[model samples]
Target: MKPHDVNSTVHEPSWQIFLIFLRLGLTSFGGPVAHLGYFREEFVIRRRWLSEKRYADLVALCQFLPGPASSQVGMALGLTRGGYPGVFAAWCGFTLPSALLLIAFALGLSEWGEALPDGLLDGLKIAAVAVVAQAVWSMGGNLCPDAQRVSIMVVAACLVLLVNTPLSQVGVIITAAIIGTLLFKPAMDAPHEALPFTLSRRAGAFWLALFALLLLGLPVLAGVFESQGLALVDAFYRSGSLVFGGGHVVLPLLQAEVVPTGWVDRETFLAGYGAAQAVPGPLFTFAGFLGAAMNPAPSGWAGGMIALLAIFLPSFLLIAGALPFWEALRSQPRIQSALMGINAAVVGLLLAALYDPVWTSAIHGPADFALALLALTALSSWKLPAWLVVLGCGGIGIML
Candidate 1:
């Protein structure tokens, strides 16, 4: 899968792309960082869907956007491969497994609360630590080779670790862009080919407009109709729209919206959250669980569907809105430099996440530490497939 083969010559069937993403949806665990590992291997390395430079650029684009970064990246990759239908296929394949599992949990979640063995889940988390460490190492080598960029990566990691908030992510990326602009002036002057836009800029503008209109109008409609479904839409949509820094960062906004409004009780909410950790897709799929488990009429599959769509809709719209202009926006030398900085900062963000939620929560004892090292060795050196490593870790965890 060479870079040139993907852009102009190669044509992967939508079904083939869907199946690949579906496998990823079912098998990918360990959060966004781990998902990138799986994607880089499957798409960039194996399939050659895009070049490493293009993939990195796509990642850098998603980092600054306010949606599930992994999902958005998958969708954008899909769109690049096969246009609009490909976009839907990519999202569906990647999102469905966890959405269905969480929805099932929502409907009958109380009957068997937290049924997944805690040890097995812990093993998955430990596997995540190793996976993320690998991602940081690989991406750091590619994105932060020089001392100055390495410094940027370190500071970004430090800032996120210290502040541990979405605002901090925004700050770091912004600061990186400013620094990148100044520091990368030399690199920007180098000749570079422009990337082709997948869709018209007018189409992109329309999507952005629609996103804004819905962001503003949905709440008012919810109030006027006084409808639970509409309110659910409004709440989840706002959660998707407002939150920056995907993954765990979206959790608090969601907690605030549903728990306070009595859409879901605290116990049910926490249980679903726990379940979400062990699932194989984006953490945002917790929306599906919440929707399916909500009190009153919205507590069923339909509700779950609504929530899933609401939470993910913003991501689709943003991706649709952004990708068309990306080539033009990024072609500027200053913008290129800034993106370089932001790319380095993204590696730092992944590092911070790896340490906190991934490492701190998983590596609790010497046994856990040993297991993580084993998993890391398997992945990095032994070259075991990621899914196999995940399964092996779970088996080991059960034994422990």
Candidate 2:
């Protein structure tokens, strides 16, 4: 990225910048974690928007926060790289395809919720176990390479697993930050993975406020119209906004909302989740499966569109709301300390997540354990591309 006096350089045109995000949204494959790799490849490695260290800092911050880390990172990257519109493009591009797919899935599932009883979805759950376990192994070693950070990871894992609290995530991150600052640890911040532009503090707050208002008000407006659109909006918005872990974590919440409404069924819901793991980009696209599957009160494609749009809207709004203000918050020393701790906690939380729901639910027996071992070895030793591992394993899953 060409350097400019923050005040003097003309920003990239919004449409052109939007195209970059759109391209990322369309082409970036895998779920949120994989998406992060893809994002680094594009914006940081390819575009050079910021050094790798800066990008890591941002990733750590988002990981600590409550929303979708990948989407938030993407939008924050955009806001820094371009501006408000940049954030918009990054979000829209990232969210749309999966949303469209989930809506379609929803349409079909609405009529077919109870067709099967076997744990076909079990395969995906198992695969998720492998993926996250691998993620924990891979990230744990790399991110928490040092002894202090390792200690932070341990404390975080115990807190979440033993005590059972989300604050554990916050605690570990804050702890790591204090340690990192005092020790001047995590010495390698990497280098510029991307470049950045700053927004006025006022502009940042404005975008966030606007997003919050829409989030609160849109459903109300939709209620006024007596349209089903509000339900879809609330579901997606809440899924994108409230969940902290990522696509996998977001699943249960999304299912609960759609399933109880009698919108989509259990079998189909699992099917979409399974198929989503196999698909590229954000797992949130499970929405696309759900959307396509839905049958609306009014009927026809309108329902599908509503479901898809509603599900994805929150991700976009969140990006808009969060990205603009990130720089100011990240710059403060204490806040930075807090985020560092939070990042470590996020890793710990991820660790706990891998064991209980993921491994236990996924690894049924020796065969499943063997497969997971294979995936971990493939990830760690063979160092194959993520997509290759996913596709090959997915093929094996279907066969098994």
Candidate 3:
């Protein structure tokens, strides 16, 4: 289809876009992959906002860039339907429900967490073990199908565990990308239909440049000013910028950033992550939970909103930046190969995380191991909803 053919589709008002996504935000449970399924149902199949090919291409572009893939797709669809206004409208609609829910959770946890039953929070932490294990299992199967990729995954896990620093994580990703570019020769798929959006390459470049500027400049500004807000922004922004896989992959980065620095305790961090699985919308909203739960000055609704915006800002910027050049980039063999290696490396990172904070902190005894195992079975074998599994674990925790 030609670009103008797509441009000629009926444009929607910003409120209409918000309402549609609001319904989705409330109803769309599950993780990034499930959210994409919900989006496809709502937009491509139901509303006919864009063709299947166009939606697939858009998904590809978002996946290629860092940040939440489903949220990025929502932003792109909103931009297609209602211009820039639709971007914020869609983001607010889809994001706010869960972000608010998580923030409330944080506030409540702070107020009454001690009054709660003994193993309730432990159950939540155990739920994290299952959820993250599921992520690692599924991602490894898909991304590291070959011997070469499996080797890369193992080496990446080893390196991250040995170095055990945020900077090392970044270096590992870069190294994996280089190794992918040189080693793997991916089979190029047939050319996809061009994206219907009419964003200019110049505008795309501007957005891309802005993403880089914030990523690099935020830390320097934070260091110079020594402000907690700036430091929070810098940490969350960098986490959002560097995350290549999905929300689950952000665990180690966030734990490294907040836990060691004493912004939040390891136990609270795991509990919040466990609670995050129950909420609808993007898992990145866990940032809101972490922000609100921080021991620092910004530790309330104010901090939650800041962290939510900082983490998701990259998704918006990246989607805007890459949409124009997606057609050329997606067709390249080297880019495809690099993405494979990067994805495999991400799986490794998650594996390391599962061992450290998620497992070491959560599983303390035989009962803990059994509970996590049960949760994993419910998730992978029974194919139950995550919220259901999480609640079940919590209830069992109370009993145990």
lDDT of 1 by residue, 278-377 (tens): 6798888989999998887776899999999999999989988887777667557787777778778877877776676567667889998999899889
Q: What is the lDDT of candidate 1?
A: 0.78
RMSD of each: 6.7, 6.3, 2.5
What lDDT score belongs to each candidate, Candidate 1 first?
0.78, 0.62, 0.91
lDDT of 1 at 59: 80
Q: Clash number for model 1?
A: 1
Q: Per-residue CA lDDT of candidate 3, range 365-395, in tens?
A: 9999999999999999999999999999999
TM-score of each: 0.67, 0.65, 0.97
Candidate 2, residues 1-400, lDDT tens digits: the string is 1223122123566677777777777777656777789888886789777677877877866775556678778777666755556666766777766556555545544566456334445555565666666667666765666776677778877876775433334345456666656653223332343225554445546656766787678768777887676666666665565555455655545655667577766545655665565555566666656656665653335655555555555655555455446655545565545445545555676787677556655677887787767866776689765556655655666567
Better of 2 and 3 by TM-score: 3
Q: In model 3, what lDDT does residue 54 have?
A: 86
Ranking by TM-score: 3, 1, 2
Indicate which candidate wins on lDDT. Answer: 3
Of the pair 1 and 3, which is ahead by TM-score? 3
